[model samples]
Target: MADDGPDEAGEPEGPDGAAGQPVTPDRLRAFSDGVFAIAATLLILEVKAPAADERVWHALRHEWPALAAYAVTFLVIGIAWIHHHNLFHQVRTVDRGMLLLNLGMLATISFLPLPTATLGGHLRGGDASAAAVFYSVSMAAASAWFTLFWHHLCRRPQLMLPAAREGASRARRNSLLGPVGYAAAALIAPLTPEGSLALSAALVVYFVVGRRAPATRTRVLAE
Candidate 1:
């Protein structure tokens, strides 16, 4: 009979000896990166101009709503990828649970382009309110999944590197900010479509520009 010990092969342990199958985050990250790329690529598909207009340039200019939608979805998904990198950086290994949560997040991410197109098409149409509601609801759901994923990572200290645990507390709380903003946008979407999207966009920009690690690392470390 073989003696089971801490250093045994095939029983690889995490930094904090968190119990789980020994799976690196690289494969998971690679898969997620592909999803993000596809979602971004799909955004441009809805930006086409309407058929047969006398003023070509003017017609092109009229497509601003589609362009705007593409830009907003692009930026939001870009931020999601950044957040994904930051998270997987800390989480050295993964188990079934991590994969499941990440899948949910990716599912929401993959669904973004559809609502983005819908919202853009309806922005200046009679369906604007309905479009705003649909778009905001989709964004809110995606935000929730992203927040849940980050919060799950924060809870598993054993899954994180020693240095990562320091920022875990703030990271958990910050993750919820995006979700709250999205939900607020959803609630107010019927009253004002443009205002709701503008608010959601502001939240996305604030999240990236405000909490960028280089500028804020020392503050978190000092705590």
Candidate 2:
């Protein structure tokens, strides 16, 4: 397969030419898409029906917070998956370290719904400390995984998409926000859990709603 270098369209070169060969990215992409689909489906399993009418109302009123958390995490995971897909689209081959990072990132992502449920449940129960700690730790772990993946990519820049230069820098900046916000949440978890959770929620909104200026992105890419 070493001699089967892909063409510009990511197709493998055949006896005829690169145009006739199947794209290696198809298999890898399919595998990654399967993992993402499973992860998204797993989120719904955490939802339980209310036992009483009052409970139903309570659940309805309270579900939004957890639902919001779920939305943020789901979309974030989706974005990362998309980014990963695009990255590998440009890559013709994978190495041991890259494979390891991909596996680890996928493993971490699979846990997102559990934490989202935990956050929603604890918040509704008024278990401020438990909820804050759970949510913060979950975000932190995901962020750390992202950081590890980005750092690894930086070390192995040749494996990345050619256009990933600006995108990678954007990823690095995005990666820092989660860890920093989660660390802050963790620090205040014991003393002011509600405050920490509020901060965390705010951070999530910022992540989803804000834009990274292109000028700064270009500068980072240049460096």
How accurate locally, in lDDT, is each candidate? 0.76, 0.65
Candidate 2 — worst ten consecutive residues by lDDT sum?
Answer: 214-223
Clashing pairs in 2: none
lDDT of 1 at 137: 82
lDDT of 2 by residue, 93-189 (tens): 4555555666777777787788778876676566767777877787777667667766666655665656664466656666777788888887888
Candidate 1 Cα misplacement greater than 4 A, ranges? 1-22, 50-54, 213-223
Task: Give one clash count per candidate, in the order shown.
Answer: 0, 0
Give lDDT for model 1.
0.76
Q: Write the per-residue lDDT of candidate 1 for residues 1-223, one digit (tens) a residue.
A: 2232433212456788864454467778898999999988998999985677558788778887778778888988987887777777777556556777888889999999999999889989988888988887888888787667666656656666777887778877777877788888888888898887888788877876765642233221111
Model 2, global lDDT: 0.65
Off by over 4 Å in 2: 1-26, 50-59, 62-65, 89-92, 163-174, 212-223
Given candidate 2, what's the lDDT at residue 142? 69
Residue 79 error, candidate 2, Å: 3.4
